[model samples]
Target: MKLYNDTNAFGLVSRANHWISAFLFIGLIALGIYMHELPKSPEKFELYDLHKSLGIGLFVLMMLRLVWLKISPNPEQISHNRFEHILAHSVKGILYLAMIMMPISGWIMSNSGGHEVAFFNLFTLPNLVGENETVHEIAEGIHGTMGPLMILVIALHIAGALKHHLIYKDNTLKRMLGKK
Candidate 1:
């Protein structure tokens, strides 16, 4: 597979980034939901730390992905319908926004709650804000709201890809899959 995008299809780098980010997002979302109800204990704390670490990892990966996109432009959308094209772009924009917002909000939430975000126990990340219950609550609310909403947005993204592949019989999904 090619490393850079052509006019018709995505390259290996884009496909790798997309698939890695997709799996990470899904794992983080599932972990977030599952660990929410765990009773307070060592295990819960461990899981929360894991979640924060993974979130930070995702943030770093996304920053790198953005840089990669700038250096290697993505393939054009294959949709012929203007509305479908617009909607596809809109959903993608929202996904990118969420990818950035979720991690920052989580970092703020952790810092404001007087918690250190340890990355896989390798090192601690710098605090973004001083301890403040109000800020903590607000950030918490944003993170909480974004998590569930992300599920819906991700569903829409996947559904759109499937629609293009199955219903429209286009190269939209194939391009992302690194196929011609």
Candidate 2:
């Protein structure tokens, strides 16, 4: 199987990482929204637990992706214009920033709320921040707000990729999709 990305396409591993992270991010958002809407009940608790679990999972995947990105070179730029290049890089940078920060903020919020964060009913994550009502409230607000922003960013990213694929007929989407 392909191990490293080429100029025209991403490798198998990168594609897998990208898609897995995408699915997990979407799942976490859905669970979080549902949890927020639910009344104070055991079902809400369960949804929160699932949200925490998925957040931790996404964090792990993001860390792995960082390592992979550093070690394995990615496809070269498809745009020659400096403006386009900057825009492309900025979009990716924001996505990476959100992916890294969102889960960290969630963990801190949970810890501040004195909630136990578990990973798929496997192991419990240690609290990063001490319990405090104010901290919990602030962190929860930030964490909750960041989720929708991330969704927007991801949507823009996908739109740009599709534009490259269907309109510009460039290799941007193909590179990410592992196509040649």
The candidate 2 region of ten consecutive residues with least summed lDDT is 171-180
Backbone clash tally (model 2): 0
User: For residues 18-59, what per-residue lDDT tens digits would candidate 2 score against the true structure?
Assistant: 989989988888788878989999988888888888788888
lDDT of 1 by residue, 68-150 (tens): 88988887778768998898899999989988999999999999999999899899988999999999999999999999999
**Each prediction's Cα lDDT score?**
0.90, 0.83
Per-candidate TM-scores read 0.96, 0.92
Q: Which candidate tops TM-score?
A: 1
Each candidate's clash count: 0, 0
**RMSD each, Å:** 1.0, 1.5
Candidate number with greatest lDDT = 1
- lDDT over C-alpha atoms for residue 164 of model 2: 81
| Pairs of colliding residues, candidate 2 | none
